[model samples]
Target chain A: MDVLRPSPSGVVAAEITIAEPMVRLRGVSKVYRSLRRNGTDVEALRPLDLNIARGEFVTIVGPSGCGKSTLLSLIAGLSPYTTGEIDIGGRPVAGPYTDLGIVFQKDLLLSWRTILDNVLIQAEVRGLDRRKAAARAAELLALVGLSGFEQFLPHELSGGMRQRVAICRALLHNPPLLLMDEPFAALDAITRDQLTLDFQRFWQRDRRTVVFITHNLVEAVFLGDRVIVMTPRPGGIAEILDIDLARPRNLAVRDTPDFARYTRRIHDLFIETGIIKAE
Target chain B: MSTRTRNHADAGHPGAIEGKPAGGLDKGEAPPMRRTRRRGAGRGFRRFYSVIATIVVLLIWEGGVRLFAVPALILPAPSVVFATLWERRDLYIAFSVPTTIEIVIGFFVAAVAGILLGILVSFSSFARSTFYPMLISSQLIPKVAIAPVFVIWFGTGLESKVFIAFLIAFFPIMISTMVGLQAIETDMVKLFKSMGASSTTTFIKLRLPAALPNIFAGMKIGMTLAVVGAIVAEFVAADRGLGYYLLYANGQLDSPGVFGAIMLLTVIGVILYYLVEWSQHLFMPSALIRAADLTQATM
Candidate 1:
């Protein structure tokens, strides 16, 4: 329970020390070579500067093709950024850090594995002792409201449940940082709301540092410590809104005037950046 | 894509809804569990009809043969074939029994060899790059064309028959296992990587299990080829086994014997296929259940 409180919008006012940020991206840039143009390089991500502190839930919201996924990948050390050095906990970011967990938009559940076995996959892969981890896995499943569905397969589950399982899988290892790419985007509106709420509760409970990507303004406002709005292609941070929402947020907070203000502020920012079209 | 059961309105299943929404519109309907009992009965009915059709075909053949009265040498009736099977039970027990033994032994040996070879190739990218080409090219060279060479290499005995079967069965197993191994879903691999899984863990948990279906697919094809290979090898050089028995009968103009041996081999192949399916279902109950559910829902 000593897990750091999940700073939904970790305000600079909190006097949080930035000495050893959980993740630091300093002037990071990524460019891709276009084969059609005889391998002429195209810029995808311009220089970026950001420090993600441990236990902070930062959500990146952007229009399509803004390289939000690329940023997450760079943090996970799954890919290399061309121009700048990335550091996690004072160490330089390198290829594929085991301490960083990720969940894709797809459930990515192995059809052959049982639900319980699927959860055990992470433990088996890392050569981690599973007996202890199994208890943690069950606990995480219960936290995600999937307590009795451990025996189910991905196909057997609804879209929302599969996503919940995916979330559970990412946290099964108790990684210091988690990266999610538009996880709730694939679910129905109702399911998405449920999973979003579930994720917020889980984050509050575990306090693992999370970097989630989405285009949904409400999700960004509701879940993140800081909503980092990204511009279009060759993405750059357009605005970083600090949300001062109270703890233990539930459906009750959803109807609050403050929630509408946050949502409206994000919509206005989206219009300014030309990401959201006026109705 | 509308699955079978969900397409009930099209096939005229009972209680079909006329205004049912297109695919993905079944949100309000009960889950598939509630539908399996009814769908299973429909499947059973289809199978029953197929059996009846097969019986009718056999009866028609029996009647035609009786009306034509063709000699057994030219065309043996279904009844005559059955009679041959019953009457020569003693002879078949000796010769055909040995033949079936060789078929089973050769098939199993080939399956193991192919799978092991596939694993070896998959383990080393270099081996897959180098050996896969040769493996595939070897298939282009007709197995029937080189039956004599196989007989020479493995010798004109069970070895030759087994080698041919091994050759025939080898490619499907190798190719399928390779595909299965290569088909390791990127997400599953990434999932493991995020968990700090070692290469060994990735293979055991994701690659190996994922390849089971592909391996089974290869095994099914290998099984059919094994029978073909055994028969081909026996044709070139052999004094026993079904392949030899058929050729010997053909030479002696013992038409009943030829038909009986052919029938026995077909039966064996069918039995082998179902055995593989049954076993796959037993080992992978979840996959089977999903497949069954999919079939029912689609039906």
Candidate 2:
């Protein structure tokens, strides 16, 4: 386990010793009941327990219909879980958790707003100081190599650029927890690789806790401190493997034996669980 | 007969003009330089074709009328209609003023009332259940059929014409507004909720702006319909306006004057529709890009 470090705002070192996990899920499960289905229920997720320490980068990999997205929504308190306790920063999540950022597969950038204004929506919604948020937005956009594109509308940019703007919006508030659900799934292969690298660099800068959901095995291993492999339908954790990779890893690191080993382990798990067919 | 004409006017007139720029940008991923050049050439060609086609049609009408030696009482040539319009411009202008006022005021009232009622229907289940059905049933009644009733209730003043215009215009606007509000992506709403945004914040920032394109579409339809409604009301009972002028000219067997009045009404309808389209561009410049992207995605 990585040692808990004092927050940059200068908390006493002694307090770090007793720092609680940023997120805690105990026996969390979801069953979707439809009246139109004659009261039949669909179990989306099974009861599961997990802990994510502050500043940890956790990625979840699963097959389609494995409740990967449901888990993310559960953690975000965006949906009601049928059973279990979910705690974020030691507080029980009752409703939509405000002190976090979420990115979905779609960029969801407002069509009418400029890229700068899209990022500023976070501040506008949160009622943050405009000048400070604008400065921060500019910095985040620059970090994503989108400095010159701020005044452009969402459609003027490529799919990859739009997702980058989405990332900037999510990070604008500088939330302690970031939840991403297949954010780069819509991008091309090369753009996806570049964004994965860019995302890792972004994470390194602030080291916020991220629960990234993806179906891509390589991405789970490449970006995560630990990758949680999940079972198909009624999803429960199959395995949680620590990546044990060094910081500031590049795309080149993806070709390394360690990276391959992590990805292979995940791939093997999927095959064993019948999510992948050998035939 | 009036209902048929209104339906034809509402169907696809403004859409053709507004859809051009959007179609140009449909290939969003295409190389910018190549795309812009192609778009410019394509748009220019289309405009050229449109003008040529219109001229050809007019010329054919003029030639056919002269060749057939068609009775002037039966059909006035386009040139004759133009001459009649120019010679009596002051009279046409005087009559058009009242009709324009009726359409404008009625359309303004409809837009305000329609948008507010749409918001109410979308937000409140009670309003939806109670008013939505009535609104739908109201549309089923041919608005032209009720023009006489409006005349009886409001008398033969601007009020009757304005009321008829509002009645015709409000339905499309209200329905479009409702659809726009409800069409918001579920995930987008969830994002707003996760941000701790209040209902008002969500409605104002997300719902309203996202709904603008749709609202503008409704407004375009409504503006044209308002013109129809005012004219129809004048047809029922009015001493002035283009509809009354057409009737008067017909009574005198002045086919040229009648054709001239019809031409002026066409001008008013086209201008009003384009005005709504222009406001949409003013309010939401990215609407075209969004529309283009949608087409591309569907394709």
Among these predicted structures, which one has the highest lDDT? 2
Per-candidate DockQ versus the true complex? 0.28, 0.31
lDDT of 1: 0.76
* Residue B271 in model 2: lDDT: 84
Worst 10 residues of 1 chain A by lDDT: A5-14
Tens digits of per-residue lDDT for model 1, B53-160: 989998998898889888889989988888998998887667767566666777788778877888889898898799878887888999889889877887887888
Instruction: List runs of model 1 lying over 4 Å from the truth.
Output: A1-13, A17-20, A33-38, A250-279, B1-35, B39-53, B68-70, B286-299
Error of 2 at B124 (Å): 1.0
- lDDT tens per residue, model 2, B98-187: 999999999999999999999999999998899889889999999898778888999999999999999999999999999999998989
DockQ winner among the candidates?
2
Candidate 2 lDDT, A11-107, residue by residue in tens: 3311431477789999999999886957779999999999887777889999979999999999988899999999998899999999999898999
